[model samples]
Target: MNDADPLPDLDPLVPSTARVYDALLGGRDHFKPDREAADVFLSMVPHAREAALVNRDAFLRGVQYMVREAGIDQILDIGCGLLTKQRTHEVAQEIDPEVRVVYVDKDPMALTHGRALIDTGQTTTVVTGDLRDPSGILAHPQVRAGLDFERPIGLIVWMLMQVAEAEDPDGIVATLMAPLASGSHLFIVTWPDTGDPAQRALSQACLETLGNGWARPVDRVLKHFQGMPMVEPGLEFVPRWYPGDPGREVPSAEDLKPFERTQIAGIAVKP
Candidate 1:
């Protein structure tokens, strides 16, 4: 077995962000540390976990749009937590089972789960690496094995960039998206500091304690995907991004203000 294998000596005492998210999403793979961390974020805003679920749902819709509308079959999902139940590859492959997916995350527990669920790189791979480091991420054996940059690829950086605030977020994304073909697509969801007084207050409180990284403004957050063609109604709250369920109402521009909704999402085409 490879030394980085996820099964052995998994650290339960130290918090795993992916495991923490798993717990938050009502999954059973988390430890006490994960639970405690989740509580801290949740306490700040009762709707914290709800926001995550909403964002995940939007991600599914966006992936479907990429496959059905844009006809993109290759996906590179950065920060794919735990590769849980309903995920990027699963949704994308439902449309085209051969859709190649490369999941990138630095969590050992997430890597372990990926190994158990996704067997090889023939069409899908779970890679262990930090999203902040494009070199290691882009050059990962699994990413190279599954995706061809010479062809169009869909990039999904969902609910993850908050950890990379110290690094140049814009530059990182630019570097990552630079090599894709013309029809390639980039999808991003950022936890912007919500504009609503209560939401912003709550998120601010969480950021103070989490200290994982600082939050960003919505405009600055959208700026991460410059030089890409952001289609109509670009960069709105996650719920506003291509909703699969027609019954869902897009949050009003007012309700989506900072912290009111945790994710600012958009799908942009590489022109």
Candidate 2:
């Protein structure tokens, strides 16, 4: 991995979703705008930080299951945010050094940082693409070259909530998965709308500050899988999935905070 190149000129006043997420994760790469947005979000939803941590932890667990248990050697992580430690490639490659991973994100800064932090050798690469345009991402030269469609791929869609309802999130997922060979798997983490006023306020705050994203109802979010067979413990709260994974200490459902219950995750496989 090489040092990141000098970033392009960008407005510090503008809040970037990736940077805001970094702020939520307690990372140091965010700017004033990002921190301000995060503060505003936290003011309304005090558990936002804990929720972010839970989401990340669950995502990493999903990656471990996909690579170490499911025996998937290739991963396509769509809407991957800023590069962070214990990310997809790190977790996957740790299990098998030859694992191939392609990180996809529309944020220029995220792409740049990912490119810098990752090995960028034959085993890992970062591509610039939007999740809404699944076809564009699938057809990207780097994506096609970095992964083989004939092989089972572990597709991670951790930020599906970023796509608005008008954008046909379900269709986007179907298009992305259609070309992959059977036995491929999908890992998803998203906020599920429970009609709570606080949740609605949080969704509105995200849309206003980040320029896009809203929480979908749990049933609607589940439809994104398009009837694919789910892995064990289907569509549970993020912290509840695979709690038995080594070193993970999951709280009981009754003990979980409200925000923890708001986010749901699951892994499904194409038969």
Candidate 3:
């Protein structure tokens, strides 16, 4: 293990953002506190589970696009929660066997669970790192060893930016992205606070209970990736991007309306 990667003490009574997410995704890697928090959120907003599933499905689409269309062979999945379903490495390496991936998260349980579930021999590694410290993540021994900083990479920040408000989300993104070479792509999924007042309240309650996340509007979130050129159907709902098939149907405004207030997703490239 790297010196920067320290094992954190697990608190079973407190609901971690990652564990709450795991419970939402129908995974059993959480404690009682996590389940209680998830249940409370669900009670407030019953559609949350469906929304999470949709976001996850859309995430896979983005990853597949990066590997098959964008020709990206390396990926850095930051804030990667517990390895529940189709993971970054599984999707990327399936397309290209030589693909290398690094999963970074601050949660020790997530790191430990990921190690147990994922095959490390395929140049895939799970390391403890905070997204707020972009410099440390970019320079971590695991990241430096597994990924080529000089080459293009698919950077996935799914529902991760929600955790950092003090860091100035835009600056955090910019700091990490500045070093990657041109052609590098950024895939982001954010939970934008754009719903009805009641929905917003529910979202806030969920965050307060689970801990360490905030919901921001899509336009405000887009400002973070100022210089990067977005792909077609830019900065739309997660379900809106390449809706029916990878290169097929383009989702309509009506198609996006359902998920509009819940989540937003986008893919941009460094020019």
Candidate 4:
């Protein structure tokens, strides 16, 4: 990967959601502003770091299931943050080297870092796009050329919480999924509001720091699936999804700490 300075026009003073997420994940691609934002978030939610780790682990598991069991050979990871250790392409390609992946993100830093790190060849590539513009992303030339729309595609919407309600998050999901062939899977990971006062406060803290962190209720989040059939163990806390998988051992949702229940995830298939 390129160890050079960030892009010339990129402002280091502004804390990007992607960078703050990277900082929360204990990654090295964040700036001082991002680290400060992450510190503020952690102060509000003491288990923020642990929640981030759980979210990443759940995402990796979802990717593995999509490739190994669901027979999905191509992926479109929307709002993909900075390049992490076990990224979508890495996990999917490990199972099958021919798997194709297209990473999309609005953060300039993420795009720059991804371009420098991941191979932009036939099997993998990164594109600059915003989640708010689903049509634009779907029409991206690289995205169009990288994968076949005629077959099943795995759509990973891991940063939906970063999109506020005013931005039409549900419509965004619908638009992104409408064109895909049947049998395509939709994997989502987002913070869920469980009506707890503490959770509301945490959501406020996130909004103040991230500018677009809107934690939706479980029902509203389920609407993003657009009536598709959810995979077994439907939308649940990150730690509880597919707990039977190797290396994933956790207590029941009722036994989980308040902070441990901050995030929720699930996979659904278009019928």
State which candidate has the highest lDDT. Answer: 4
For candidate 4, give the lDDT of residue 234.
84
Q: Give one digit per residue, the lDDT tens place, for model 1 in 91-174.
A: 999999889988887777787778778847578778776777877788766678789889999998754445555577888888
Q: What is the TM-score of each candidate against the true structure?
A: 0.88, 0.91, 0.91, 0.93
Candidate 1 collision pairs:
194-258, 194-259, 195-257, 195-258
Off by over 4 Å in 2: 1-9, 243-252
**Candidate 1 residue 42 C-alpha distance from true site, Å:** 1.8
lDDT of 4: 0.85
Write candidate 2's Cα lDDT for 1-271 as tens digits. Answer: 3243233456778998889989988999889999999998898788888888888888888999988889999999998889877788888888998899998887767877888788465898888778888998899888898999999999998678878778888999999999998999988988878776656766877887887778888888889998998887788788789822534566787786778776888888999
Local accuracy of candidate 3 as per-residue lDDT tens digits, 60-143: 888998899899999999999898779888888889989999999888789888877784735799987888888899888888
How many backbone collisions does model 2 have? 0
**Over 4 Å off in model 4, which ranges?**
1-9, 243-250
Clashes of each: 4, 0, 0, 0
1 or 3, greater by TM-score: 3
TM-score of structure candidate 3: 0.91
Residue pairs with backbone atoms closer than 3 Å in model 4 (clashes): none
**Candidates sorted by TM-score, descending order?**
4, 2, 3, 1
